[model samples]
Target: MRIGYFLSSEEYTPAELIEQAKGAERAGFSALWISDHYHPWVDAQGQSAFVWSIIGALSQATTLPITTAVTCPTVRIHPAVIAQAAATSAVLTGGTFRLGVGTGEALNEHIFGDAWPEAEIRLDMLEEAIHIMRELWKGGVVSHHGKHYTVENARVYTLPEQPIEVLISGFGPKAVDLAARIGEGFVSVAPDAEMVQRFRSGGGNSRTCQGGFKAAFATSEEEGARIAYEKWPNAGVPGELSQVLPSPKHFEQASQLVTQDMVKKAFVCGNDPEAHLAMIDTYAKAGFDEIYVANSGPHYQGLFDMYAHSVLPKL
Candidate 1:
């Protein structure tokens, strides 16, 4: 499986993130998966930079193939606008960019003052948005009128030589089916063997399948767990809360219920190379073509060095 670094736009400055991208490439990671968020899940996790700007910088800073871990094109931004941004990114990256899209969360979409729709409606919207974006990416004047979106005489003038591959992110069976129907690739947070089989069964046999997990590398296990709990306790927030929580403050409140123990259990914390490799193996065994690890703490250089020397070689 190809190993990649997950750039958390919610936690680091744009410059620092670009530096991390450079570091990741130097360490031999084959690709990058970046979070696209309008707000950090909780205030303690810090800044949320514009993901498109960071992608532009990363394209210049590193040769690694980049994929938005998942961007929500159904809301906040129209599919036409996302299509244009993604087309530009693909051009900037010399066709090494993949657009991973999903049904959005209220945290980002609700900021536009629109009522958050149910998951089913959101899925429909996502389907329509993907169709519209694909139409726009064809490089001519295109007009679309669908249930969820409308595009009138829209065209993407600056597209890459290759058609941008659309990767769909999904958690449930229905969403997985949607990905197989429309996506050239698929992404999910966990390594579910059943989900991979489902995607393949739905006609995604030859598509890229990606999964991501979190890790916190530190001098000691205690320090790593502490940082993970403080900065990413929100990771432990159960189920639909993450999708519905509208503000950082709301997430902070929800995160208070997430304990350090839970955080430690969710992430592979500490400097044990074997432990990190074991965590990555879960995805590999589950049939993921690629796995991206997000470092949750400050010791990224150490993390990269460890991965390059030990974990990566083993994989």
Candidate 2:
């Protein structure tokens, strides 16, 4: 499997993100995955750079391909605007940009005081938004009047030589089916073989499947776990709470129930190259074509060095 680095916009400033992108490229990572968030999950992560602005900077800073580990076009931003931004990004990156989209969390999409749609409704809106974006990318005046959105004589002027590949992120069966039906590729954060098989058998055959996992690098495993829990306790927030929580404070409140061990279980703690390789193998065995690893603390350079010297060489 191809190994890539995931840049956490929620945790890094714009300059930091660009530096990480450059570092990843130098460390021999194959690609990049950057998260799109309007707010840090619990404010301990502490930074949320505008993803498009960072993407523009990243294009100049590095040659590796980049994807928005997921952007939500259904709300917060209109699909039309996202289509234009993505087109410009693709062009800026010399056609190395792939738009990864999903039915977004309420934390980001509910900022306009819009009522959070249920999962089914959000999926429907996502389908419509994907259709509209794809239409706009065709280089014509698109006038879409769908059930959830409307576009009036819209066209994406700045486009790449090819239509930008759209990778859909899905965690459930219904969403996976939709991705299989419409998306050029699939994205997920889990190493679930069943879901990967479901996606392929459901019509995603031969499409790229990307998975990601988080790591917290430190001198010792316990120190790494402490850092992860302090910064990303929400990693242990179970069920639909992650999707439905509307604010950082709300997430902070919910995350109080999450234990440090829970967060540790979710992250690959410490600088053990074997642990990193085991995580990569898990994703590979689950049928992912590519895997992105994200670090959650100040020791990202340590993680990168480990990958370059020990982890990546073995792979």
Q: Give the candidate number with the greatest lDDT.
A: 2
TM-score of each: 0.99, 0.99
RMSD of each: 0.8, 0.6
What C-alpha lDDT does candidate 2 achieve relative to the native structure? 0.95
Error of 1 at 285 (Å): 0.8
Best-matching candidate per TM-score? 2
Q: Candidate 2 on 159-268: residue-level lDDT in tens?
A: 89988999999999999999999999999999999989999999999999999999999999999999999999999999999999999999999998999999999999
Q: How much lDDT does each candidate structure score?
A: 0.92, 0.95
The window of 10 residues in a row where model 2 has the poorest summed lDDT is 154-163
Cα lDDT, model 1, residue 7: 96
Each candidate's clash count: 0, 0
Off by over 4 Å in 1: none
Clashes of 2: 0
Q: After superposition, how far is residue 213 of candidate 2 from its true place, in Å?
A: 0.3
